[model samples]
Target: MADPKGFMTTPREEWPRRPVEERVRDWDEVYVPGALLPIISKQADRCMDCGIPFCHDVCPLGNLIPEWNDLVAREDWRAAADRLHATNNFPEFTGRLCPAPCEAGCVLAINQPAVTIKNVECAIADRAWEEGFTPPRPPDRLSGRTVAVIGSGPTGLAAAQQLTRAGHTVAVYERDDRVGGLLRYGIPSFKMEKRHLERRLEQMRAEGTRFRTSTRVGRDVAADELRTRYDAVVIATGATAWRELPVPGRELAGIHQAMEYLPLSNRVGEGDLVVSPLCAAGKHVVIVGGGDTGADCLGTAVRDGAASVTQLDIYAQPGADRDEDAEPWPTYPKIYRLSAAHEEARDLVTAPAADADARLFAASTLRFTGDGSGHVRSLHLVEVDAGRRPLPGTGRTLPADLVLLALGFSGPDRTDGLVDQLGLAMHARGTIARDAGFATNVPGVFAAGDAARGQSLIVWAIAEGRAVAAAVDRYLTGSSRLPAPISAYDRPMAV
Candidate 1:
């Protein structure tokens, strides 16, 4: 245990966000630089080191939480980093992007606040990089097997790193101009800078993971040819087919998909463009969705100097505290939360003190109205009850020059002809279907990540990647020693 009485003595604390006024002026990350390190040890000491740590089970990666917590509390940062990397290939990404289900499963959360596990993980990863503790570890000998992995997101990257370290020749192919899929473009720079991603890629390259960017399977290279060339193929293509807002005036000039708008802004950050073609400057922007994508749009719009930003959520506002009867302990619960982007939007001049909530919960978009010139002008909406039935006399309109649909994705896009050429079966929900071992219908072809599990968190993506790698290893050799964190059909604790 960390400090025998640490849980009772220390209070929970988190990384402080940069001031809204200062942060909104730049696209830098929202955190105050170097703020987490000083207090992270104390926060990590709060872990109880329970007899049965639910946090471990809740995490898809099955990270050694208590061990790392104890090491961090003892100021053994190098050992903490080793423990963190033992299960997770990219703690940096999960620390920045994951919603932290482990915290929800924390035993301490039964009464007091949970330990800052995510912050502690992020601190260790950053310190490891600063001290040059993160280095390439190439395989000792080649296994004489070749593997092809499509998509360079977290899943593909994790799998590639694992296979490379395990003595296999791995090649990751990405359709994008750069290696990273959403990590390079889907995510805005303000949330997580591109530099963090670049450094990791450098390490992967040194570890003998070949990256072939600007190459599209089933397009530039035939999918059948890839299968013939490699001993096995793993599909890590994420769920990118976005859901549509089927409403009137759908062809309005200013209305764009969240992926389309976000990528262009991210391109500007990558220095590929001086300005985004879908710039939100001086426009009234309306985002349809209350999830992280919408929050991302909110932050991007604010940085682009939008005149006003409004986010609409179809579901009712969640309560501040967990509903014990509805959602018991050891499960993730729906609770009202504020992101860094929401805080910046709250400080907007357009958001009044009385009703500063940028998110309008239980509000449904009826339709969009466009100007005579075909540009979006206003959005029609109405309040709805729990059943999603529109309430009477609740219809209203808000000015909207640019509208972004952050309604989330459907499944892996088959337009590339990869699924058609490979004859892979898809689940009823539209994701690629796989057996318990993460194998597709076709032999020697496997699926993992969002392509197989539907849109999910980065933690699950990494877990699926690691598990699928183990399965592929076993398929090649009679037996395998690689760790499989979770099965393909495994689900997270119900919320």
Candidate 2:
């Protein structure tokens, strides 16, 4: 431990964000640049470095948190980065995007605030780049085996990198014009800038991991054809079949899915468009579903100059502190937390009838009302009980010109015929059915990430990616040395 009494003395501190007034005006990352490095070492010192670190156990990537935390506290940037990379392929992405379940499982979190493991990880990754610690580690020799990975998302990217370094020829196919699937279009720039993704892509390219953009597997190239070309196929295509609202006036104009609204804004940031065609400027935006996607939409609308933005969450507001009996320590608890987007909305007073953080808890959409032009004008809603049954006398309406449905995804999109053509078995929940080793019903085809696990965290996606690569490597050769952090059935600690 860096300091014997570090956990006792140190109060937790996180990276400060840019002012809401200033950050909302631009598409750059919300965090103040160069802010984390200064205070990250001190924060890492707060780790107890437990005899049995539950933080490591809780992380899907099984990131060596205490080891890296110690190195970070010592200011050993190179070693910290190395430890971070041992279990995770994209620390930059995870450090920025992951919700940090590890923090929840931190021993200190049983009472005091958890260690700033995410900040330490991000600092080490960023500093590694500045100090030229990260480089393309191409395989010493090729195995003469070929693998084709579908999708260029976090899962696919992680799988591709691992396979490439394991001496296999890997080709990652992306349907979009760019390499990153959601990271490119679905995720907003305010959360994480594209430069971090670009640099990682460049490193992957240098390592001989090929990326084929603008190529749909089932349309441009047949899925069967890909299986024939490659020795093995790994399906890391994320679950993108978004759930529907199915309420009256859902077909009204100005009503769109979160994916549809978010991608256009991302395109504007990518220089593909001067302004988003579906821009929410001067419109009353009502986002249904209180998840990360909804929060993302909320932030994006604020940046686009929405007149008002209200987020409707189906679940009631959770308590400020953990419910010890219901959700004990070392497990993620349902608690009220304000995201950056919520803070922006609160500071700007965007949601008129919402809570302090701009969320209407336990609100269920009744129906949408449209104007004479068939454009959505207002949304009718009602407060619901724990069972989602509407509570009488709680009916209300909010002005909603632009309504975004952030209800989340169901399964991998089958519109491209990838699942049908491959004859992959699917779970009842609409996820790809995989064996304990991440293998699909199809002989040489494997599935992982959201496709196999349904909608999940970035850490889980990366863990699945790493595990699937090891399975593929073992299937090709007799045995393998790759680390498989989680099995196909391994699930996160959930209530």
Candidate 3:
């Protein structure tokens, strides 16, 4: 337990973001630097460490939230880092990227604001790196078995690290030029700089995990060849095939998928390009979708100096507070909250009260209007009721020189021909089919992460990676001691 009566006395305090005006000038992270360390211990003390710690139950990684919270309160960062890394291979990634479902399941959330679990987790991870407490744990001896992991995202990285430390030779292959998949390209530097990823990859390399970059498994190297050479293979390729909107004028020049635009910006951060082809500079940008991806686009566009920005949501805006009747205790509820990007966009409003939020809820896109050059000119939309039926006299047009589709993903990208090569079966939801043991029908072949679980949070990806690694170890050695955090069917309250 952190502090016996601290939950009642200490109010929840989170890491503060830099002022919107100041943060918009640069592509660095939005948080106010050095503001978290002083107050994080007090915030960690707010954890009740309840009899039934639902925080652990909801976390896909099954992280020891209470134990770490107590350690942080006592200023024992080394022990807290150990407890954190015991389950999560990459706490820094989750602390920055995850939506933190553990906080939603907090017992304190029933009455008071939940403990700042995510911020404390980030603090411990950052401190560990600073104090050199996080060192490469190389295996004492080799197991004489080989494993090939497809993809270098969180899942593949976790599995490779776990297996390597457990005395197995592991090699990770990535299609991109760099090792980190979405972590290297899909996310912007402002959200989390690539240095965090680079540091972790350095540790993995020291632990003897071989990485093969710019190598497509099905094309550059045959998948069948890898299966023949290695004793076992694990597929962790993420869900990259994006969902599309097939409305009229969908082929306009200025319209693109979020993945297309985001990766370009990330390349610019890597010094590969001076300006992204889909740059929103000096343009009126409109984004379709109201999830975290949309918010990411919003922030990127704002930093790029978009003349104006508006986000569209098909569903109605969530309530400011949790609706208990709709979602009772222990269930993650949908509530309105301002993300860093939302806060930045809120400062750029010039319209009337209706458009003050820079977001339009119950909004449906009728079609896009284009100029003579086949470039997007404006967006045609209509306000809708609860059922999404367009209301009478609610049609309007907004200037939009650029349009981005952040409408999420459908399934894994099969264009690589890997799935066809393996003859793997897919679930009804279009994800890879896996049994309770996280193994596919093909013997010695397994799948994990978004490739197996569909579009989800990094936390779930890491958890599935750890679990699948244990299954693979057991298959290789007949018996294993690795911890399996969750089964393939275990879904958490996260994207």
RMSD for each of the candidates: 1.2, 0.8, 1.6
Provide the global lDDT of candidate 1 against the true structure: 0.91
Candidate 3 lDDT, 263-381, residue by residue in tens:
99999999999999999898999999889998899999999999888999888888878888887767778888788888888876712233536788888999998999999998899
Which pairs of residues collide in candidate 1? none
lDDT against true structure, model 2? 0.93
List runs of model 2 lying over 4 Å from the truth.
none
lDDT for each residue of candidate 1 in 288-383, tens digit (9 for 90 to 100):
998999999999999999988999989888998989988888899989888898888877754342133688889899999998999999999999
In Å, residue 165's CA in model 1 sits off its true spot by 0.8
User: What's the residue-level lDDT of 433 in candidate 1?
Assistant: 91
lDDT tens digits, residue span 1-495, model 2: 898799988889999999999999998999999999889988999988899999988998889999989998898888988888898899989889999999999999988888988888888889989999999999999999999999999999999999999999999999999999999998899898999999999999999999999999999999999999999999999999999998898889999999999999999988899988899999999999999999999999999999999999999999899999998877888899899999999999999799657899999998999999999999999999999999999999999999999999999999999999999999999999999999999989999999889999999999999999999999999798999999999998966
* Prediction 3 global C-alpha lDDT: 0.90
All candidates: TM-score: 0.98, 0.99, 0.97
Q: Model 2 Cα displacement at 254 (Å)?
A: 0.8
